[model samples]
Target: MKTNTYDLIIVGGGILGTFHAYHALKKGLSVLQLEKDNFPVGSTVRNFGQVVPSGMAGEWFDYGVRGLEIYQSIQQEMDISIRNNGSIYIASDTDEIQVIHELSAHYQTKGYDHALWSKAQILAKYPAMHADYVQEAIVFDQELSVEPETMIRQLHIFMQAKFEKYTLKYDTTVIACEDGNEQASLTTSNLEVFEGAKIIICNGYEFKILYRSLFDDSGLEISKLQMMRTKPLPQIQLPGNILTGLTIRRYESFEEYCPSFGTIPVPEHYHELRKYGIHILFKQATDGSIIVGDSHEYAAGNRLDDLGFAVDTYINDLMIAEANRIIPMRNDWITSSWSGFYAQHKDHMLEVDVSPRIHVRTGIGGKGMTASAGYAEQSIEKLF
Candidate 1:
């Protein structure tokens, strides 16, 4: 290949795109990454950054664990901050308590050491938590979190430094992609053209816009989620990522893989997809502020402005309410809140469709942070 050309051109510089670039370079492939935005402001940044392996089911669980190992290795080798603070799932109801017990038993059988914590034990370990409503809980010691935006920025800088020959073009949008006999050509909005032997689309929700033909029948849609961060609270101390029993009831790992938790009724609006429960994951930053979130709303297009302030207030109030139940803290200031979009697939499995010289990785759903590295590696291996 010529110096200006590349062996692979990756569109969308999110975690998935960056990981694809990283691994492709490791395989000795000249790579070029393009992003429309200057900074990663999508789901990659607007998340709790929790890598919960125990929450993943079946093959995805293995992938999550392997990805964590890779993340740790990379953190050590590359000087990044990955906090393995662990995670705790609090059960506030009788059914939720039963689910925690059953999930603990199931994870133990699967070689995972998720421990069941009695209400007293939990309250003792984290005295800030309100144990009155929590009947039981589950703790996963291997779970971890990171500052998502910082990690992406550092990774982008590191990739550019380590792979000087690899190209990263920001403020550049891939307008069209065409496949020829031996290579794929991409035309950017700036009218610049780049050619590569292979192309991988990791554009998240925008994947449908770029490759409409492939996604039209694949059951892929966009999910917009809301998240918020509270102002600094000196007294608050979260021991780990916090999850509610509702999460276990919704995630497949709690149901099919473990077969411990009984089904909680899916919300009426989300009945078709069988999605219920709110995930109130809390993690404190270095600045003594807590970031909590998220509720899902799916649509066919990018819809950020449609988020009602009332909805934001409602969710934030709910998050703080849940946090106070788990930790004894009072939040006075609401620092900031925002929303972002991610891919939602019907099967809950990421799919990589390959043409002769082109590949597309979509359907990451909400697990992009946890599964991107492993998924990207597998996609590259299948492509080249």
Candidate 2:
């Protein structure tokens, strides 16, 4: 019997929506999760897979900490491409060193595990990183690295077998949603209808089409980030997620926690790099290839087309130039490169209640992969 009914109907199967489903199922709610494609091919899969709560600040940091817990707990059950490799932020100079010291102080009161490693300690662990680039580093070993491309898919499989109430409908697009006081219903592209007590939307940058005007009126901006992957190099030994100097200056944690974050003036040479929002993060994949990159270009939610589908070679050039300064690498090693788009509010995540029953949550920005699991857990609690 095609009852076409569930306790909860979730639109979009990205990190945020999927986590929402995970928590809802924990409450024993019958869930129908709809995905526009065969599986998630958005920000959830397109990232450095750095689950570093150490890089987050304020409430989001709390969420990220909880996110780390959820990810590890899931790892205990299944092989989800998760590695407890830890995360490290290497200071390039004395100025960057000062901020990391203050960051350590901020976390000390919070009871998070962290350690400051000296130059020799850094060299002993990651020999591939240039010795000269190391001033000092703060290590968060509890942080994790996940293979983004496979994490969500494995998670879906894990959930299906564990929770019989969970139903995932991939390649199913919700084209229309009708609001109701008794029961809400949505129609898919195939003209099939689904009914549930509540509906939550977690589509990343594809923000509109469903409720176009609501998101456009909302203060949301989309950022297009460019990233690259290197060919497998068996000799290299770059462990964990390596966030360099630019990252130290850019992450929300440093800006909010470190007192000296604003005091140090970035040199003039960084102007061009900063203009494009360039930050270098490297993580070695299971294939032994190092993933490097990231440069940002932004536009308002309604103007997503302005940030086209094309990858800018110049931005990749700028990233590779910065990568050379951090590690010993040749241009030939960079085998593939691409771009990923994420949406964010300038101040925080864009959360709007379309109604008491319908919720729109997205614009999680760069923190989606790190914080969504925890954030969604809290959100589900509040909603229920």
Top-scoring candidate (TM-score): 2
* Residue 273 local lDDT, model 2: 94
Error of 1 at 143 (Å): 1.8
- Residue-level lDDT for 89 in candidate 2: 97
lDDT tens string, model 1, 210-291?
7666665667667767677878766767756777655756666777754445555434433422341356667777677778
Q: What is the lDDT of residue 58 in candidate 1?
A: 69
Candidate 1: 10-residue stretch with minimal lDDT = 268-277
- Model 2 lDDT tens row, 1-384: 144888899999999999999999999999999999888999998899999999999999999999998999999999888899999999999999999999999999899999999999998998877888887999999899999888999999999998999999899988888878788888998889888999999978886568998888889998999999999988988889899899999999999989999999997767889999999999999999988989999999889899999988888888998888888777788898888988899888888888878888999999998999999999999999
For model 2, the stretches where C-alpha displacement exceeds 4 angstroms are 1-3
Write down the lDDT of every candidate, Cα atoms only.
0.74, 0.91
Write down the TM-score for model 1. Answer: 0.89
CA shift of 110, model 2, Å: 1.1
- In model 2, where is the ten-residue run with the lowest total lDDT? 1-10
Deviation (Å) of 5 in candidate 1: 1.1
